[model samples]
Target: MPSTLEQLTSNRVKLTVEIPFDELKPSLDKAYKDIAAQVNVPGFRKGKVPAPVIDQRFGRGAVLQEAINDALPSAYSSAVNANEIVPLGQPEIEVTKLEDNHKDVLVEFTAEVDVRPDFELPDLAAIEAEVPVIGVPDEDVDERIETLRQRFATNTEVDRPAQDGDVVVIDLEGSRDGEPLEDATAQAITYKLGSGGMLKGLDEAVTGLSAGDSKTFSSELLGGAHAGETADIKVTVTKVSEQELPEVDDEFAQLVSEFDTVDEMRADIRKALESMARLDQAADARDKVLEAVIGKIDIELPQALVDSELEARRNQVSSQLAQAGLTVEQYLKESEEEAEDEDAFWTEIEKRSLDALKAQVVLDKMADEEKIGVEQSDLSELIVRKAQQDGTTPEQEAQHMMEHNHLAEWMEEIRRGKALAQMVAKATVKDAAGEVLQLDRIQPDGSITDAPAADEQAEAVEADASTDDVVEAPETVEAPAAVEEEAPAEESAEKKPAARKPAAKKAATKKPAAKKATTKKPAAKKPVADK
Candidate 1:
């Protein structure tokens, strides 16, 4: 087999591979043997039929197709290796020539692939980032301490009317234009005042109401039928109460926290805040540093790869909505984005896909230059965390990941994180106040070296926006059936996407959230398991 590459663009290449007849013979022979076992010949036993008999049964085109299917992957792999190209994802392979019945003719094919473009890295030390200075205010500590006390607070019945930060147990019904909506009534649901995950105007409508008091107010329905439409909201408060917070004392501190005294608890809270602020600073620096790096380089994107990533992202959201029993139109309405027409929504997806692809190419190259890799310990930790989140054991999650081939995606997330961490370390960091910020909390790999134990890694994840779109382990560990049947991620430009299940999306129309993570999902060519 011999292959040559043509540079279609800085980041795109067309590889033409010529497979000699000798190399094609194996797939051809295997195709005949497989077909022989499936067909019954009058004079021969199953699997014993000759090639000539099978060829006569099915035309050469049929056999040629089967052979080409078997040979394309290997040929594409060989061509990629021979050309020393690091592909962004799978290539679009096209069989341009088939030597079907010609015994001496070569089987030729062309594969167009997106490759990692070469770019120069600037000196990291020269890069500067501005972060807010770390300073824990006295009021912040007091509020946190009060919050801790509230956690151990008891529910005390209050005779007064409900107010902000109060709990109201109520029954409610919703109707639009005097027509009752189905699945639009609830009984004895406990709602926290100001915790408006339910609907708009809930806090204000519920406030100032006493037990046994009923009132009707107007609020937009959040979900179910009549989701986005304004409706007459009837709410009756069955109970009104306030949290009886424990006193700020030594005994209270001992019960609520590891600290023995209120002073100790407050000090720990202050320390934790300062530490987190520092982590945030380092995180900000990493983003700025990366953006600086990408700005210095030029990249001509491979349109095929960009299209794949775009489709992958769009399918990802569509799959989620389907699972939740929704349609794109309903989803758009529910997300408050009905105004964002289909063309505009798709165009936005394309833009994000392109940005993500561009960022990945840069990060991957930086990782290679710095020789960054995911360590066994880090991977194990990630596996353990993922397993816990998935409500399974580490061994089980690891085994599942292996079965479905997700380890590489996880490893790539870890590797790129490390590379960005290194970049952050070399940058000059200053607080918004112009003080030289000390990023002692950040490691070269962008992890918090001394972060507090609770939700430490989560903070790190929040800080490093670059890995925001990495497929999480639990998502990959979903039921095997879901995995196999999942819509294929962005397909190559050559393939058409599969039709989604024709389920009606009944979700109420709403606006899409601002800045939903359109993060780079430019990894393994699998249907993206979105978080």
Candidate 2:
């Protein structure tokens, strides 16, 4: 087979291949064998029919058609390999030349793909980013504790008028132009006086009303029958009740949480709030770092990739609409959005998709330069953690993820995250307060606090410490180039030694692991069983 590559664009190429008769012989022989088993030949056993006899009976053209059908896939693959084209999706193949003389078959095809961009990544260390450091105020923790207390609080019947925070049980009806609407009537509906339930003005109408008191108010229906239209809503205060919170004492602490005393509970709350604050700051900083990197770099994305992503997004939106008991047309009409106004929706999705794609491209380039990677063990640990989160066994979750293509997609996300973390590690990040900071400090696991400052003494110490750790864990396991680029970022950020944390460590570390572990054994064992 002879093949030639035609350059269509920087990222796309068309391949033309001519298969000689010699190369097509095996497919022809196989096609004849299949045909011989299916057809009858006089004075011969079922499997003993000669190819010449079969061809003479069925016509050589019929045999050639079967041969071409059997040979197309192999020919196409060989052509792709010959030209070294990494195809993204299916290629549009067309038979450009065919002759009955059996001299040669000329086939031409074009593939539109998203090839890896060829560009040098900017120096990540030179990128300067500000990481936000938001302090969790004491009020925030107190407010959270109060909310928890309220959650456990009991409701007691009150003889007085309903007030904000009081729960009221009542019967209600709504009407448009004085005619009651079918969907707007309810009986024995329990509602909190201040909660925005039932309708826009129903809560306000019931507030400050004593038992048996009735009030009528007007509201624009937010959903269903009279949606976006004004209607009269009537509510009655049937039974008024108020929440009675337990006193904030040792008893309350023991009742609501594992803590023995209120002081202990308060300390836990403070710690939790501090942790949340740190996480928020880290997330904010990560975003700023990415924005800074992207802003400084000028990279051109393939138009084909953007178009493909847009098509995928459109399909996703259509699927979501179908799930909501509406077709795309019905959704547009009901929401008062024009079908032609797709530009408005697609414009937003496109911007987001572009940002996401740009981030991935930038991080991947950086990862390649930095040689980031993830260990198989790390990936396994991640998969196991995900399984636990989904409330299933690891084996079951792995099967589901594999079947749905979620596993591969998730691994890519993890790989990208790792690369970004590495970039963050090398980046010059400052706190919102303008203080220079180490990346580890802002990482979710608090190990960022151990990262060396830009000082010579700290750098020397950290270098020595890292060398010792590597020496101690001498089992060298190589990860994929893409995985390796990001693996270190995750490894360096996580202080734990084991990829899958020990049972004891699991209790201490509630933060979810980054990936799921897919055991090839479970999937492979089934094939063996079938055999």
Candidate 3:
């Protein structure tokens, strides 16, 4: 077989192939046998009809057409391989030549599609990025603690008027344009004062109302049969309840947590807050880095990929609408948005989808360049971890996910995360305080570093000090006493006269002093000469 390829576009290719009848013999044989089984012949078993007799009856051109039809796909595929063309979608095949004398078969096809682009990956190591360091404020922890308290709070009946955060049980009736609505009446409905349920004014109508108190307010119903219609709603407060929070003491701590004391509970909460803060910071940092890198690189994405993603996004939106008890048309009608606003919807989805696709391409390229890959063991461990999180057995989860091709997606996510972490580990990261933080202190970077030698040296010194203190206890005491005894003897050998006699007695004093000095000199000289 001989084939020629012509470049149609960046994504499309045209291939013209020619094969001799000898090369197409196998396909012709198979096609003839297939035709024989499907056709009826007198005095012959099914599938036993002779090819030459069938050709005589059906016309030789028709039989040849059937054979060419059967052989075209494989022949085209072979030509594609021979020309090294990677087709995205189906090819448009044309039989350009049909030989009357079983000579050469010429087939021409054009593949209108998108092929994966070939380009060298940008230098990721040279890409500089800053991971934002977000400080977890004290107020954030306090807010989290308050949320926990709210989760544990119980509702209690209150004699006072209803207020925000209080649940009110009420009898309500609504009327639209002086006509009462059957669907807008409730004998007893419990509604939170600020929850924005019922209607916009219903919450405000119930607010400040004590038991047996009633109020009337007008508002528009946003959905249902009375959508966009203004209604006068009368609400009577039957009961008002307020949340009662548990005391924050040791007993409360024991009731809510496994800890025995409030201090221990606070410590645990602090640690949890710190861990969450670190994770949030790491995620924010990763996004900033990706945004920076993406901004620095340029690549053209396949339009086919974008179109496929757009269709997928449309299906997803339709599914969500179906889940919400509405069709896509009904959803658009209810939202007061146009059903034909596909351009607007797809415009937004396409931008996000393209960014996601580009990020994936960048990550995959980086993974390849860095030789970053997820091992089978690592994938298995990840599956086990996810199974534990979802409260299922690893094998069951793995089987379920594999059936849906989610296992591959999960592994890809892991690989991308690992690659991003590797990049972060190599980059310079500083905290809000302008202090460089080690990668281990932030999050797992799929790598480990040994402790510094200075730490080992300090440990060795501490061990030596401890051993010396235990071994030389008696020598320490004797050495101090020996130094004390020598101190006084040395001081006595260096003693001198405190003052000189007056001028009148100088001569007499000088003579005595001279004799004492001579004796001291000899004593000092003896000590010096002994050395």
Structural similarity to truth (TM-score) of each candidate: 0.70, 0.67, 0.60
Model 2 Cα lDDT, one tens digit per residue, 227-323:
5567787888788878776688999777767789988878777666665555545555566677787777776666766676556655655555444
Best-fitting candidate, measured by TM-score?
1
**Worst-scoring 10-residue span by lDDT in model 2:** 522-531
Backbone clash pairs in model 2 (N, Cα, C under 3 Å; residues 3+ apart or in different chains), count: 19
lDDT of 1 by residue, 122-224 (tens): 8878888776666778987777665555456667779999998776788887777788765457777776676556666777888999999888888765544
User: Which scores higher on lDDT, 1 or 3?
Assistant: 1
Q: What is the lDDT of residue 247 in candidate 3?
A: 78
Residue 445, candidate 2: Cα error in Å is 6.3
Sort the predicted structures by TM-score, highest score first. Answer: 1, 2, 3
Candidate ranking (lDDT, best to worst): 1, 2, 3
lDDT of 2: 0.57
lDDT of 3 by residue, 140-204 (tens): 65565554565566778899999998867788787877788755666766666665535767767
